[model samples]
Target: MMQTVQKRRTAGFLLVISGASLWGIGGTVSQYIFEIHHLPVEWLVAVRLLLSGLLLLTISLMLGNKEKVTGIWKQKKSAGAVVIFGLFGMLAVQYTYMASIESGNAAVATLLQYLAPVFILAYLLAVRHTYWNMRDAGAVLMGLAGTFLLLTNGELAGLSVPTEAVVWGLLSGVALAFYTLYAGPLLAAWGSMNVIGWAMTVGGAAVSFLHAPWNAAWGSWTWSMAGSVIFVVIFGTMIAFWFYLESLKYLKPQETSILGCLEPLAAILASVWWLHVPFGLYQSVGTCLILGMVIYLSLPQKQRAKPAPA
Candidate 1:
């Protein structure tokens, strides 16, 4: 039994890492589509959410608890919660992150969005009345230092990217924090697929007007662009979400959050390699510091660690 449990935990960790890595690659691909193919941000977001949502929902119907899918709207509170999550959590995170990527490169956008942990920490302090500790302080300081170095490139003044990119990236962080906090109760009540699938559908429907994907210039679709779009929808959106959520069964929420930092690392590498995004020494140092914080926080607490055999 112990061996079986350990195996499941290891598998879950790998699954979470794979999901995060895929998401990072997808972000870089999205940037490519935006810069080279000139794909409109709104249309990409719309199609990704809509198509991915449908695929997930179909899978849920096929394999998951069909009762959850059908009875999702039976309860007024759950129905309302799903709508709110879809509109504020899903829509905001997706749109703001994409906007940041459009305004800047995937590296900067993803790194900036990684500040979600800081925001979440602050929220816990305020709402949950949690006590401030050395760990929290260290994490906040590292996050601030990382953002400063990444944005200014160690310059005395001004940002490396446009002011708009900074704003969008910061907004993406806020949206991510909101999504993380908001989805907890919902996930506990409904399974990952059911909740995420419905949330995506709601968010997509809400944003359908802006993109108007039906009226998009389909004539511009090339083989490369089509491949990128399909990969983003399938691997990035659907598989990524599914794997990450499945990991929650074998790992604590905090552990999964730490593992999710893999996304930023992958994004930064992909942007530097593929997009030729200029990454400075200061940015590299900042990335290391932020990653250090992630590792520190992810360490098992003394009380939680098991004793070795005597």
Candidate 2:
């Protein structure tokens, strides 16, 4: 019994780490696609969401979740929730992230999106769903301090990256926070794949209507570019989510989130090595502060608290 439990825990850690790493490197692959192929953000986002969603739904159906795959839309409340999540949460997160990358490099974009925790804390505080606490304050401070360093490098005279990138990146973080918070109940009720599959399909379909997949003018795909796109859709979006969610069976959500820090770390490394993006000392410190504060905030609070493990 003890050995089996240990193996499950180990498997969980590996799954989360693998999922996160795939997501991290996926950003770098996207950066390459944008730089080399000049793929439009709208086209890429549309293709990714739609294809990944379909693949997930296909898997769910094969796994005997056919009922769930079709049943989620039978009720108005559930269907409505899926629509909201798909449009505002999933679509926003996906679109803003790609936009951020287009405006800036992958490293900054990934780090900024990591600020979702701070946004979630603020939202909870605003609604009185959670009270103010030192830990929350620390998270906010760390996020602010980190953003300053990452963008300004402590000069404060002007941003190191384009102003537009910052705006998109911040929006990405907000959307991520909303996605994380809004999907909890639905995911619990409908199962992760079933709910997210439909959400992705809905978000994809909405975007498809605006920027139809058949109409995509994403640059001519070379062999390498094709491989990269495939990796982004298959490993990054679909399998990454699967592994991350699957880890939940063995590891606490908090533990998975903490381990999920590997995503940004992987992105940063890939950005620096693969893309030749600069990562100076101050920016490095900022990244640490941001990621550390995130990990800290993920910790179970000393006092009783609402939301998360705390």
Identify the leading candidate in terms of TM-score. 2
Cα RMSDs, all models = 5.1, 2.9
lDDT of 2 by residue, 124-175 (tens): 8898788887767878898899989999887768998888889999999999
Poorest stretch of ten by lDDT in candidate 1: 300-309
lDDT of 1 by residue, 4-68 (tens): 99999999999999999999999999999999999888888888998888888899898958899
lDDT of each: 0.87, 0.90
Collision count of model 1: 0
**Model 1 spans > 4 angstroms off:** 1-3, 298-310
Worst 10 residues of 2 by lDDT: 301-310
TM-score of 2: 0.96
Task: Estimate the lDDT of model 1.
Answer: 0.87
Best by lDDT: 2
